[model samples]
Target: MDPTHADLERFCAELKAMWEACGPPVLTSVEKYGGPKKSQVSTILNGDITTVPDIDNVAAILKACLANARAKGLEPPANAEFDYWKGRLGSLTRARSNHSEPGPAGNPWRDLAGTHPVWESTTDREFFRPRVVKAAAHLFDRRRRAATVLAGDDWLDETLAQRMTDRMGDLLTGRLASPAIRFGGVEASLIVLAPLLHQVRVAESAAALIGVRPIELRPSASAGPLRSDYERFLAGSEQSRLVARTELTGVPGRTGAKNEIGWWLFHQWVMRRQDPVPTATAPHDLPIAEEPLRTVLAGTLDRLVKLFHLSPDGLRNKERRNLVHKVSHPSITPALQDVRELLVGLLLVTAHKLAVELTALPSTIVEHLGIPNPVDLGRLRALLTGMTWQPLEVIGIGLYAQCHHEAVLEALLAHVRQTDAVLGSVRDVATDRVHLEPLLRLPPRASADFVTPAPHPDNHTRPAFVVPVTRFRIDETRVRELLMGEQLYSDRSLAIRELYQNALDACRYKQARHRYRAALEDT
Candidate 1:
């Protein structure tokens, strides 16, 4: 082996034994004048949960590994990107650019690579390995999976150590029939401590155990993944909100709107499933529609078909068109089309499966109500005006009260104005709107990040609420609630100010260019 590579290899093996300390920081000797004199990955993380890594213990080990690798005449990674054991690490680099008619070289990572050299604390969610959790209990649940510390002041007696090893087996592995193996103290401890113990077990397995007391455990010092953003993302708390902001800035394609086309594409890219198979089949009685909307599915689908090129699948303008497209339907009224297609498209596309589920229900619910269709209601009322048998009046009132028909709602609102019992109609209609109903928003939902109610598409809900997809705009307020928080207004992803800036810049650029050409002609 090459001596450099061999030394690095040896250093990597030896550094694993030294759990804690700055012995592994590769660039530590390079020396900085301000801020953190020595910057590694975890130290850069501070306390943000979103940026922690899955295996934090590897910080020191990775540091040592990098140093040894670099000392052996290997190059520093061109910034943070590298591949190890088929796994890739996201890297950010800072370096000086080439000579460009100047004495001073500029930082290449900042100037050319479009990144800042000074590392900042990250905010990312973390995912824990459930298997590691299971394995911790697997190894330690016996005899409460106790750790035996040496009692002696120094290294303790070797014979005592050997005997202690036997005692550990007896404690953990011995068959205990007496006292029914009372788990009084440790049972609750297990519930609270099981997860922590598992982390410890995982640490121990890597030959990177951090010491633990009976009640407390500290994180192991081993290797620095050196990418706090990614690490914290994996190690952060699970209690994070459904809507989260990441340290990552800028939209993927163009101007970095949170709603930017590029960001939207990236969202879609991450949610795409390479495999076509589903985890389970849908329900037989799946209600694809909600109340008044369920009552109007066919009528609505009829109007939208030519506009959407609608078949079974939802909207079909183009896959990547903006949510509220400027294109107008030739046949429909523009205002209705705007609300029906734009707002409704936003609503349905967001909760499309719910819309589909709402619309999927049979149109016969209108007929089942024993009332004439809105198309025929005027004539029906005229015929019923002079008729006898007041019982029909009772049936009519009951049906009107139950149905979510807009005409019914309008009539009832009128009736309520005349006499307030009709407010019951509005309240009943609005209150009962939330009853669980299946509506097919999308057959195979293309985006995992699309906002919808919880309890999953695979799961079922109750009696059809038959809600309009537009009614679902109530949920967008929730998105607004997340975005308009005190700390989040400045987030570029959520900010609208940049959009104003883009418009202003375009106007200024055009005016300035015109003036520059005019000056050139005069000269």
Candidate 2:
């Protein structure tokens, strides 16, 4: 189907050569058979003018193919002439054998099937009388003709022996088996079952072995072949399923609370000074959040801003925008809440990858940050434009949503405890970073927004808590050196995670560092 008409023309040309190589027979009486003379045989050959192919030549080709095919257990030609022709070529000839077997008396199959008149019945017609008859006849005709041309006067005796030997060989090779056949619907019959014609019969034994009762296997609808992957896809192995579940839920003791570590890391980073330790309230009149929370929140905000490539709130108009601005007007708040979620997840995942890399078996750092679900990545996306949020891949929408919810839970919990202002366990969230916004979305509570000291520009992206993995005295040069080597630090996740882990160690082991609960204790 993919081929064009040109391909068909080329195939027809090849057919012409094959016909010439084969000595095909035509009905002949040396005079009665009428058609073009030898001089006008162009109809049977390729030339400028196209003509119908010679019927006899096509028949011979088909017969030869069928004979070969029948020997190989493939389908064969349908016409009776071809089947007899196959038997003739396959078996040796003898005077005692059928005359038409291989001598151009046409084919036996056609005569037996009444395809030819009774008087015109060929030696080929009588040859198929016995399954072995054609084999003997074909051998005689060929060997006798060959011996006359090769061994001279001794042709008769010598040819008989040679022809018999050749026929026996056909027996062993199965070329002496069933006659040629062709495409037809349920068309086999015992009368048609005879030696194939025109094909070379190699070993005589093959003829003896064929045409035996065939085996037919009962078809089973369900017993078909299957793909190799079938079993794996269907079978729910305990180990693989377990892995899938762990990855989906992010195992509680695994990836959840790494965010809490951020809260801790932030505090330590803002102030590397360990002695006469800097306090959150130590900065004179500044009423920052409790010691560690203030510094941690501030540092975390700085990191978030950096992670998103957001311009600091104060820095502006550095990059070109869609419209010209007078340094006077600013677009709406760049969304920061949505951006925070992605950064937080990256931090958590980074921590997990680190733990596996370092072979560090830290328990439950992420689990502590198990935020609620319905991870509203979609809702959060809208919020970003409303708040002038920073850059964050949308993929982390679900993650940020969960983190945002976690923060809300922490905030609600903190509010109730600090002011003895008990509210029902939060049912639904209206906005991120819980404000005095009433539970009802309708009339914004007059006190809903941060009415007290407003959040600082630097504090916009900062979440309530984050933890760093570790902290130690190191020159800025040393920190950079480790980064360059990817040894002591990696990215935010590694640096922040290590800092947090260190702070936790410092908090628990007083002997490890100066005791500083101000940085960690929930303010």
Candidate 3:
């Protein structure tokens, strides 16, 4: 007896259930009873094949299961089970035979329309509404299925699940367009229409969000189609003038000369122009009252006194004398006292120079003078007191701004010359010592105490010294000619195309080789 589709489906279901319940023995073990391989077994159980399995194969599977059960020390099913399956198979065969009877010929019109008789009788609205509703329901079901597959074994909390649902709703309602919906539109339509609708919804939502109002298709006149003659004249005049200027100034017999001409015109008309008033030198003198000057001087003196106790005895001390000498004669020795004194003397000199140059001493210089670390207040005061006469004279000259103060100028010049002479001597000594230090160091001994030993001569036969054989000298010019010569192809373009083709072929060959190698490894 043959089995019907329902009988095959039921039997497959029952067989799958039994296989699942028994710990699902491997296909290899089941094959001993003439059962198919695992893939064939899966196809049969899944009812994926058009035809049903033979009764003999079905019986073989039952026997295999019984064998497996007994081997596992489990009780085998009674003969009743076999009887039941046999009866079911027989019934299915009878039903299939009865159902196989030829039916009325199918109507070609109905077949062409792909509709049933009931559908043909109903109105369009009645037929479509249920389909639309069913399609919508199916779309939602598909989304749920997709979400489930994506979720896998992950425990999605309520909040996350709610968010996902909301996002899906947004996608469906055209509020959010996702890439999946856009690119997978056609594919998703076959499954369900939600994805395509999602993309449309998203686009609509975006357009709405952006407040893109629909514009009239017809062209509208701007500003009542009026033209400003003055503006037109100005624009035309400027364009003509630009063209004339380019033609007039452009270099003769040169390509791209207009750009150069424009640049030249710009430089002459704008960049080369000068301002009437000079900006470099501005008068900085502020006409303040004599009282402000006195006040500033008095404050400066008081701070200096407090900063460095400026007593007459402290000025004439041995430490102050040594400080003056250190400033006059800079040394290479890292003596902390000498460095501190020298820095203090230089600070005082710089302050005097600033007082002469600037109308008011800058606060920054004053701050530096206030620091009393290695050089204490007393030492700074002593150094300042020693130079007090020179600064006063220099200040007077600077303030009077008269050319007849040559005496004072000469004295200052003489002092600078002396300082320069001392610096020159120090520089010469440093240069000579730095340049000669390595050369002056004691040389290494050449005798037994330091000399390197030489290798002893061997008494064995010496290997013959062989000169290298030169086969060829590369002709670089010829090589370049071979690569670049027009003779290689009918034209330069063809040559380039040929080179490109060779490169492409090489790349393809390499890719194929790599792919083959990878396939071999996989196998």
Which number leads on TM-score? 3
TM-score of candidate 1 relative to the true fold: 0.15
Query: Which model is ahead, 1 or 3, in terms of TM-score?
Result: 3
Instruction: Count steric clashes of candidate 2.
Output: 88
Candidate 1: residue 306 Cα off by (Å): 17
For 1-523, candidate 2 gives per-residue lDDT tens digits of 1111222233345444433333332323111233444433434334323323344544545444334444555532212233222322222222223323354353433233232111121233332233223333443444333333221110012122222223222221231132321111001111111112111111121121112211111122443222112223223332122223223345543433222332222222222223332222121221232343234333333222222111122122223111111111112112111112221312222211111110011112222223433222212222211221111232110111112333233332232232111111111222342431222222111111221211222244564244233534345445656675457555658777887899988777985443456555645
In candidate 3, which residue pairs get closer than 3 Å at backbone N, Cα or C atoms, i.e. clash? 2-93, 174-201, 174-202
Q: TM-score-based ranking, best first?
A: 3, 1, 2
Measured against the true structure, the TM-scores of the candidates, in listed sequence, are 0.15, 0.13, 0.19
Q: Which candidate's lDDT is highest? A: 3
Mark the regions of model 1 whose C-alpha exceeds 4 Å error after superposition: 1-55, 76-280, 283-523
Model 3, 1-523: lDDT tens digits are 1224554676578777766555455656667787777677778667776565667666666766666766676654322134335544554453343334322221111121122212222233342333323333432333333323222111111112112223223223331132222211111111122222222222222222121111111123431211222123223432233334334324443232343223222222221123321221111111222343223322222222221222223333445424322221122112211212322222232222212211011212222221221111122222212222111221111111111112222223333333333323222322444322211111111111111111111212431122234535465446766788865666889988988999999999999999999999999
- Local distance difference test, per candidate? 0.25, 0.27, 0.32
On a 0 to 100 scale, what is the lDDT of residue 505 in model 3? 100
